[model samples]
Target: MVQNPETIQECIEKARQRLYQIANQYPDLWHPEVIRQSMVLDELINEYNQATRLKKTIKI
Candidate 1:
């Protein structure tokens, strides 16, 4: 399994690249599992971004 990137931008770019690859290769065969995985990855990226924002707001 591919590991997620540490930075939010890298994580998003990597997920987008994966989705593009799948879309190109499977054209009309959009698998439900792949879409689900993409959604999960997006959720993870969003969570990471939220955590990072919170960390930045902490003065100490």
Candidate 2:
């Protein structure tokens, strides 16, 4: 299934906000929970990048 770029952007924003909230609660950057949230954000970013790249590469 094709994913909407806008939807992916929204997910990225939500994940980024969640990561920031988690970081604020846990000052330790390496805390497991914080690290987990960071990873989640990273994955969203990667997905967004891939989706956008696919849009650019596809020929009509």
Candidate 3:
């Protein structure tokens, strides 16, 4: 139901912030919690990219 790039951007920002928090909380870069949050941030970014790309293609 969410086709808005603005909404996706907000989600990406939130995920990025959360990843930073988790990374700071865990000193080890390889910690499970840190890795999980990093993956989540990556997914949100990828989703945002895909959403934007789709919109561009549709406009063309």
Per TM-score, the best of the predicted structures is 2
Measured on C-alpha atoms, candidate 3 has an lDDT of: 0.86
State which candidate, 1 or 3, has the greater lDDT. Answer: 3
lDDT of 3 by residue, 1-60 (tens): 435788989988898898889889998999999999889888888888888898899899
Report lDDT (Cα) of residue 49, candidate 1.
69
Q: What is the lDDT of residue 13 in candidate 1?
A: 73
Candidate 2, residues 1-60, lDDT tens digits: the string is 557789989998999999899999999999999999999989888888888888988944
Off by over 4 Å in 3: none
Worst 10 residues of 3 by lDDT: 1-10
Rank the candidate models, highest lDDT first.
2, 3, 1
TM-score of each: 0.56, 0.90, 0.89
lDDT of 1 by residue, 1-60 (tens): 223235666767777788777767666545875686579678868767676667667746
Residue 8 error, candidate 2, Å: 0.7
